[model samples]
Target: MADEENRKAVLARVHGKVQGVWYRGWTVDTASRLGLAGWVRNRGDGTVEALFAGPADAVDRMLEACRRGPSAAVSYTQLTL
Candidate 1:
């Protein structure tokens, strides 16, 4: 198993047309496949918020994937924490 200290967790807010798309579902599937633990939810301000936690590399990969969500034109991703 990877070192627990090597893991990373982040809270991010995705911008653009992320709503109504399958971004959340895609995130869940992608994150799950990556063995990540987190949750994704839609914000009222036309954005999507998600928490990703897992191996550093896996989390990084998930962040990259969020840049271009499923069928969603992502403008940018903001890491809150």
Candidate 2:
């Protein structure tokens, strides 16, 4: 178990060409590899919604990866909650 005091959690919505491009799959794989606890899904507005929970450093790395996603053509506008 992670130390809850050091754990970080974020809920984010990623926008721009994130649908139908294996974004969710990539996210699942990446987050799992990072040992994060989270869920990801697509929204009706063509955005991807995700929750990331783990070490702060890992979460930061995940957010950075999300900025580029799986393709160079992909763009992101992340809103965190």
- The prediction achieving the highest TM-score against the true structure is 1
Pairs of residues at least 3 apart in sequence or in different chains that clash in candidate 2: none
Off by over 4 Å in 1: none
- Residue-wise lDDT of candidate 2 within 1-81, one digit each (tens)? 557777899998998889989999999999998999999999998899999999988998998888889873285857677
- lDDT for each residue of candidate 1 in 1-81, tens digit (9 for 90 to 100): 459888999999999888877888998999999999999999999999999998999999999999878865655799998
- TM-scores of all predicted structures: 0.91, 0.89
Q: Rate the local accuracy (lDDT) of all candidates.
A: 0.90, 0.87
Tally clashes: model 2. Answer: 0
Model 1: weakest 10-residue lDDT segment is 67-76
The candidate that wins on lDDT is: 1
